[model samples]
Target: MFMTTDVTDLAAVRAEHVRHIATTLRDVRGPLIPILHAVQEDLGHVDQADVPVIADVLNLSVAEVHGVVTFYRDFRRAPGGRTTVRVCQAEACQAVGAEALGEHAKRRTGVGFGATTSDGAVTLDEVFCLGNCALGPAVQVGDRLHGRVTPARLDALLGEAR
Candidate 1:
């Protein structure tokens, strides 16, 4: 049900949205995080073009805004797929074949970590932990978490995602 914006109009629209969000939330204490979150919530990702607009509204330098965006793993620099798949790469998960699972996912999805599939159906990502150590090799698809995932299980999950 997600629709993409035309490339030609994307920048202008993105700037407008970022400016509005920053302006609305400017008065909030420690407003940067909330403004960034709101921008991402509405625009799917924080475009580079948005950095200046946010900085201008918050009375911050472009570097300050850009630094925050890049520092947080939660913020996407570009649009992601409709579904996000996060595989835990923490010690617990890696101890139990999570690395192999992650590799399989990359090969199957034809995209590396933080990259969306060509068709925009899925985005593959790696996470440090999912707090399911008892159940290592955890994979989060969209909002649902699955533990003890195997290659076949991951394939099935990706199929469902697409």
Candidate 2:
């Protein structure tokens, strides 16, 4: 599900997002990382429909543009589901069994990074960090962050949302 969206032509929105991206990169020299972030934040996702527009706005080849978007872990070409569940996958979290946590989430949510539940109750993303390194295996559900997440702990955490 999208947030804070209003009626507006897709072309107009994409162009506006492009302008924002251009403006954001006006001071920076190379790389469109900043622009990409701005665009994603503004547009929710960089829909494939805007690829050409983004290329023109950033003066990048289509391949180059697509490559950058896909290469980065942060970019999303589609809107996130209702609940954005971000489980840390960084070294600190992984050291504390984040790998198992990820599997548990996949099995439980029936979706992985960039995926949403059928009813859109949740969206799961394997983020690299949540800045809670001391609380390894941390999982962020929407705005709330939790530490020491296990399958059972995650189950209880998710139950609260229902």
Candidate 3:
């Protein structure tokens, strides 16, 4: 789940963490994405406090780091819940009622796409594809893939996740 900290504490910790991460990966060619990914992997999301530290270490502008973070859908700016629920929204899945399924998932989870539940139990996301086209309306819950997910099935999954 996204971490909640006092603003001052968060800034202090984020700077140290971001600096170490950037320093470790600075020698690599085009280390931007890898460094950001490392930060996200460690911290769950890339905090705004991280951007300036990362930029300074890499000798780049804060805008550059911010741009990359914003451009990548995989990079979360805020913390996600304990479980991530991704529903495929690709053309193949959509052809099989994925849209309806997506809506159902959102309503059932009480959050729209890219949102985590207040209880920090689940995060709902819309994905382009799960590479399970044959099984339309595919969904990936955490690391497990399931296909042909009906609204009832989605509810069951959410129940299980909770």
Candidate 4:
């Protein structure tokens, strides 16, 4: 089961973000992208309410704003479920079987890439790199990164989070 936030309040967040984005547009060339990124960074995700605000502020069609939002994988328009589990899927990690480790991690957490558990205790994320190539097959729980995460090791990692 999934629980989403109230859309009405999200609209308010978007409205304010739009105003800020408009200011950025005047100051920057491709204001919409940066503004959206900033909003996501500050708010964790972009709110739907801001689409109209962005469109109006950037002099873009609402559809255009929506397009840019969806185009980038980094931009999230909703909140993360709860605990974030980032599995390194970069080449360095994969060289040491990170792909298989990621698959196991997802199954162990009961959530796929970009998904959260029913209890909202965990959200699984796929990341390309953690700059810990030496520690291939790395995973980051919250902000702590772990290396050489085998299936057995995953249980230990999950234990720390729980």
Which candidate tops lDDT?
1
In candidate 2, stretches whose alpha carbon ends up further than 4 angstroms from where it belongs are 1-8, 129-131, 142-144, 159-162
Candidate 1 local Cα displacement, residue 113, angstroms: 1.6
lDDT of 1 by residue, 1-162 (tens): 998888869777778878999999999899999998999889889988899999999889999999999999999988899999999999999999999999999999999998999999999999999999989799999889999998999999999999
State the lDDT of candidate 2 residue by residue for 1-162, as single tens digits: 877655566577777768767666856876477777777777777777666776777677888888888998778888866667888889999999999998898888788776888876788888888999998899998889999887899988767654
Number of clashes recorded per candidate: 0, 0, 1, 1
Candidate 2 lDDT (Cα, whole model)? 0.80
lDDT of each: 0.93, 0.80, 0.92, 0.80
Clashing residue pairs found in predicted model 1: none
Residue 120 in model 2: shift from native, Å?
2.4
Candidate 4: residue 115 Cα off by (Å): 1.0
By the TM-score metric, which is better: model 1 or model 2?
A: 1
Ranking by TM-score: 3, 1, 4, 2
**Which whole-number lDDT from 0 to 100 does residue 130 have in model 3?**
87
Give lDDT tens digits, candidate 4, residues 38-120.
77766667777767776887778999999989998777777875567889999999899988988888888887999877877
Better of 1 and 4 by lDDT: 1
Least well predicted 10-residue stretch by lDDT in candidate 2: 2-11
For TM-score, the strongest prediction is 3
